[model samples]
Target chain A: MTQSAGLVAEAILPTFTEAVELHKSMVFSIAWHFLRDRSRAEELSQDVFLELHRRWGSLRSAEHLVFWLRKVTGNRAIDMIRSRKVRPETSLDAAAEPTTLEQMHDSLLASYLERMVATLPEKQRLAIVMRYQEDLEPDEIARILGMNVSTVKTNIARALSLLQAKTVGRLQPNTARRLNEMPGETGK
Target chain B: MTPFEQELKRALARQQPSADFTERLFARIEEEQAAAPVRWWQRIAQWPAQTIWALAPVCVLILLTSGTMLYTQHRRAVQGEHAKQQLLLALRITSNKLQATQRQVNEVESERQPNQKDNIRRLL
Candidate 1:
């Protein structure tokens, strides 16, 4: 009995460890992007993994595990937002002097866009993150979020529009025109 | 994809957890395992440590219910023994009284027999 128990433990421990190693980034990033607080995000990520451990036996396949992680992380993030009433942080003005001139412009634009996405409504922000950051399909996002696929697509579209308006509305005309010329503005 | 969306994706790429995250999680799991009550079924199933904590109240409830039942059975057994002893004592007392009444009847019958024999001799 002891030997068999030891064997089972050996098999399970490595599998669980591998799973955690594989999916930690997805779990952590979802929390970080949603909460925007490094410590809280880390804590939330830990809690999610612990939950995953508890429910590990119920997960049947690798794909199911990934889906479960996304759904749980997304739901937990939204719950955290609701419970904490966290106001979105909007201060994106601080840009460090870039070592290289070429990378500076792109980094600034990226940071600005990230802030805009962060400030969106919770569902829209979550959808956008899942769509772009996670690069998940609308159907996958809908499954994770328990929403209609059409609703998920609609949320992403609305989020893009809102971001475009916010970005272009705030920048100087020349800069706005430049941003509008960017590929995301074309609604691809 | 729009340049803005592309940039957003680049900026919001998946971030890794801290270097010691797995280690810390394992440590917490170990601590929980150590704290949880040991049970044969749990050991057999290798239940996650959090599950033991979650089921603590149920365990307590089961223990309480079983304890109460055992105590009730014990009290009933004691009461039954007491009643048995009381019935035996009552039966012994009744037996003694019946034996004393039988001895008094024997004495009366012996006294009547001697008197009847004397009266018959005198009449003859």
Candidate 2:
């Protein structure tokens, strides 16, 4: 190629792997929570980063780039969810025994919460996952989802209400006790 | 918004990816940026010169066209002065109406003579 084209090509070849790793977790979590399939999650996550690679210059800053990745990954996950509406939710424990009451704890709570989050409506599910899993503020979630901050807060509130209603009587006393005793319970 | 949300935050905070994620992302960006074959020396050489090169032909064309336009304008201005001189000469040679024309001109000049004399007296 011409010298200019060569220059362009050289400029683009150096940062492939770093972009892949930076977005791997967020992308993978979004996909995994929506699909409940690790392999699918990994594949989708890689696809999301590959896309980010293609459009890296359009992103303004590191934080802006992360927001773009989260938005794209969330939209792709919702598309996957709707496409598979007729099929069953993929269970990670197909070969293992069902979760027993004895195994319920903080770690189990995270897992349960992940599964329960997957069961929410697309917007609510994504907003809650971003808020909780990514520790993003409501305004950040709004920016990522292209929604208003109030809308993001409402989605999170609704998702929590649904989770609270569903698990109100189902949670064992021990699980409730553990939740109450969870570290940093500043008890306001 | 509540203790439960705060607890949920604590629980979910543990889901970070394997430690190498940022390094991987930066590496990928570097790789992509590096793919272009323009050597560093070539980039340094071309940066300032490229814009000048791209605009050079257009600049030359504009200058050429403007020179041509100015020449035409100069020619038109000369032609306009020549026309005015011809008109004046024709007016001077028109003997048939010269007397009547000079009589009317003298009357108009007489009417404005007081104003011109007053202005000159003020300036002096």
Candidate 3:
């Protein structure tokens, strides 16, 4: 009863194993998309959970647990990128801009988007991953990133515009114009 | 949501890592715990929060009772030393008074001896 989700207000918290089982996908996916390397993603995500295990004493509730998981994973991934100065495997700078997202298979498009997101500035990349991958609101992203809500919004908008510009280059002129004309702050 | 935004969200949707992610994670946690430097109190801290809560009052009670026992024992030892000192002072005073009384008795006997010698000479 205790290891299961705590239905009652005073219920015992979930065990560490249960927490690991429940949140592995979310944690792994964030690292996977952020780092764009399967092996490194596995390592980074595992490190995050390991950290959670060590700090399990201070965890207050399930919600707090999720917050910690996201915050730690995001910060660690960014720190890893900065400390190592890891550039994208494929050069977004030198490679041909991806102008054919329309005809690309869904899986291909997804992979492309993942790669592009991984190449963004560390802060912008984290903001985008947390924003889209976790489906978090900007305020939540700001809290996780320790940034102002406005700064988070700006990062997301700027990242979105960059991806849009690169991906939208091959779109029908009208469709591209419509996407551009639409206010991009959908996240706000 | 714009189509572009929708695509972005869809692309970034959470996916499971390799099948053994949990097993690997648990193993890694174990490895980390083993590798970390040992601190005896930190072991207690790592216990489940409920366990900590359940044991807290009992721990406090134990500490309080032990502390009080130690304090009482120390006070008794100090009092015992004080009583021993008082007894020693009393004994010393009694011995001094006895010595003074003995000396007075010896002086009276010596005075009587000299008087007796004067009386005997007059009789002769």
Candidate 4:
């Protein structure tokens, strides 16, 4: 009995190590993007993994594990935002004019969009992050967020429209036109 | 597929945790484990429900035993206090009796001494 117990204990470390290696980036990225603070994000990521370790026995498969991590990370991020009561200043209508076309190069554009996404409401920010960053479907996001599919769809659509509005005149004409023609534009 | 989203995705790409993140987590786990080593009772609490059920009678027995011991100890204390009260009452009664006997003896001795004096006077 002792030998078997020792073996099981030894086996758990490697298994947990691999799991952490596989999912740490996703966990850390979700927290980082949501909180925009590297240290806090790392702390939250560690907490999520610790919780995952505690509840590891309940997770049935790799897919379920990924889903669980995403759900927990997103929920924790939203909780942090709510607790902080950070009223984002940048609203859809209040968004400043986009950066000049010359300044909207690849890296700059990426950073600009990131900043814009960060300025959304907590739910919309999480929705957009999950939709684009995690590449999750609306239904999957709904499942993770414990919201209706329609609500998730609405959030994603509104967020995309807002992003489009924010970036409209900043990029080249072709890029701005493409942004306007994004998937969520018709629903508005 | 919009350029804006593509940019957003690139901007928000998966970031790695701190270089020592895993090590710190492990240390935390170990520290937590060390801080709260499971006690015997806690281990019992974590046992399966059936095992806990099986131990219910033993728990009841232990509770009853301890309760009986405490009750006996309380009863003994009460009994001892009653005995102490009885002893104090007996001592008070004995003291009163001794005082009464001494007064009687003093009265008798006084009476005898006066008779002896009268007898000596008659002899003289």
Give each prediction's DockQ, rounded to 2 decimals. Answer: 0.24, 0.10, 0.33, 0.21
Tens-digit per-residue lDDT, A1-188, candidate 2 = 11121223223323445545444656776677666676666656766776766564454445555667788998888777677662225332232334463456666766666666666778987887787767677898898889998888888877777665454334577666545443332112
Q: On residues B1-124, what C-alpha lDDT tens digit does candidate 1 reach at each position?
A: 7656766688787777789999998888788768887577645345654565688899999999999999999999999999999999999999999999999999999999999999999999
What are the per-model numbers of colliding residue pairs?
4, 40, 0, 0
Q: In order, what is each prediction's RMSD in angstroms?
A: 10.5, 14.7, 5.9, 10.3
List runs of model 2 lying over 4 Å from the truth. A1-14, A86-99, A177-188, B1-3, B10-124
Task: Give the residue spans of candidate 4 off by over 4 A.
Answer: A1-14, A86-102, A181-188, B39-124
Residue-level lDDT of model 4, residues A35-148, one tens digit each, is 777888898999998887666545545666777888999999888778877445565567677546545677777777777788888898898888777777788889999999
lDDT per residue (tens digit) for residues B1-124 in model 3: 6778878888898877898888777777677767887598877767777788899999999999999999999999999999999999999999999999999999999999999999999999
Give the backbone clash total of model 2: 40
What range of 10 consecutive residues in model 4 chain B has the weakest lDDT sum?
B41-50
Candidate by candidate, in order, the iRMS in Å equals: 6.2, 8.8, 3.5, 6.5
Worst 10 residues of 3 chain B by lDDT: B24-33
Q: TM-score, each model?
A: 0.62, 0.55, 0.70, 0.64
Evaluation by lDDT, superior candidate among 1 and 3: 3
Best by DockQ: 3
Give the per-residue lDDT of model 2 (tens digit) for B12-64: 54234446545564566567668866566554443433465777899999999
